[model samples]
Target: MQTTTLTSTWPQTLCDPSGRRQAKPRNKGCTMVIDKGIGQHAFADMLSTSGEYIDIVKFGFGTSTLYPLPVIQSKIALAIKHGITVIPGGTLLEAAVRLDLIPGFFRQVLELGFTGIEVSDGTINLSRTLRNDLIRDAKSMGLTVYTEYGKKLFGSRIDVTDFARTAEQDWACGAELVTVEARESGKGVGLFDEHGECREGDLSHILRVVPNLDRLMWEAPLKEQQVSLIKSLGPDVHLGNIPVNDIITLETMRRGLRSDTFELQQVPYSEYMI
Candidate 1:
């Protein structure tokens, strides 16, 4: 797929200052931005400025239902036009399951022009069977499914074995990607301690089980979290729950344009080699 490069002046004399970051329609190095509330004009501005860097646009929480149906449709259409997959928050789907409105929820989302669904159990208990079935159902409708593994509560932690099993099953069932929940706060939750520092042991365990990191989306809402993951996992690791405003900044980091990741670029050593 030929998509636009991050730079406007491609094939220039100088290479990217940071390094070569992948272009759009990328399988790896994808970035998902969290949108709580942004109107059409601002959304348009964001896209025009840094849309190429964004892979997915998530309408966070039940806010997708807060807008007029027309406005929602327009936003989804705009993202789709820019080749970005737009998905409502998994919390909305969780609510549907709670009220037994899964079918209606799916139908309404599709009708509203969402190109994807987030099957997550962050706030509630979801059985494996239902989770699998939900993935199947979403895929059956021709929508992309992104499943999430982790809880929304502050003290909730991930059982490594269960997470591995769940991630495997979700992918096998038809999810395009699986997210490790950090919520928007990114504190005291999956892979993160109370201070929002990543638990290396837990992360290493998941890495050992999964092997490939492409299928995983680490929700890193904080800049520190984003920098740490990008540094540890390399530029291609998929990151989610990013604020809309941070899209360009994150892209810069991925390319080593930011000081936090400046070493990613290949630089020549010394001028004086006497």
Candidate 2:
């Protein structure tokens, strides 16, 4: 009897249809996963299978706190082993800010091996001064800082002018990346309508304001939103708040392995045959 074994380099004929997906240690096209209490074994399995495609893992909302310290530590270690930057969700930080636990919060995350932290005021009104201070503080603690723009509200919208201004300010304050909020639903939020559709005009306005897409991550948790983004911005656009189960599916779309974006990145497979 004969059996087949697969290796990372096993297939040479197949390539990304778009031919534009960035490799690890990449500066752009980042995928941030929103982990909402996945167990240790499942997380390890996830890392084994899909960590390469994930750049950042955010323990969704305040769920990380719900886990035992040892469990959280183990998860962080697994992520670090896979070369993925992990962070507690921004809401966790907001809660910490309100409790005046910012310093200890930074200390605890650092001790737990989180390589990054997100500064966001999605649920609370975070003042600009405090926001800047938090970014600087996180940087001082030697943590990678990702700031978020826009608020999380039912009918909230992005004022393009405000977004442009705040994005620049975030960069100036040492934010490595600024994620646009779409909440977990990705509807009636920044750049999206109640129907969960992309507001192309607002998106266009944002594109005009930003110098490049490399530093901006759009939180698009829905399949339609993902399809729209990859189609509009190509496969290199950074996306966040991705559900854990959908990582590979989203990657397929980015690579044009899915029909929705197959044409966007279509390439001749024979071109790679040798």
Cα TM-score per model: 0.92, 0.93
Regions of model 2 farther than 4 Å from truth: 1-10, 266-274
Whole-model lDDT per candidate:
0.89, 0.89
Candidate 1 segments whose C-alpha is farther than 4 A from its true place: 1-19, 268-274
lDDT of 2: 0.89
Q: How do the residues 153-219 of candidate 2 rate in per-residue lDDT, one tens digit apiece?
A: 8889998888888889999989999999999989898889999999999999899887646889999
* Index of the highest-TM-score prediction: 2
lDDT for model 1, please. 0.89
How close to the true structure is residue 41 of candidate 1, measured as C-alpha lDDT?
92
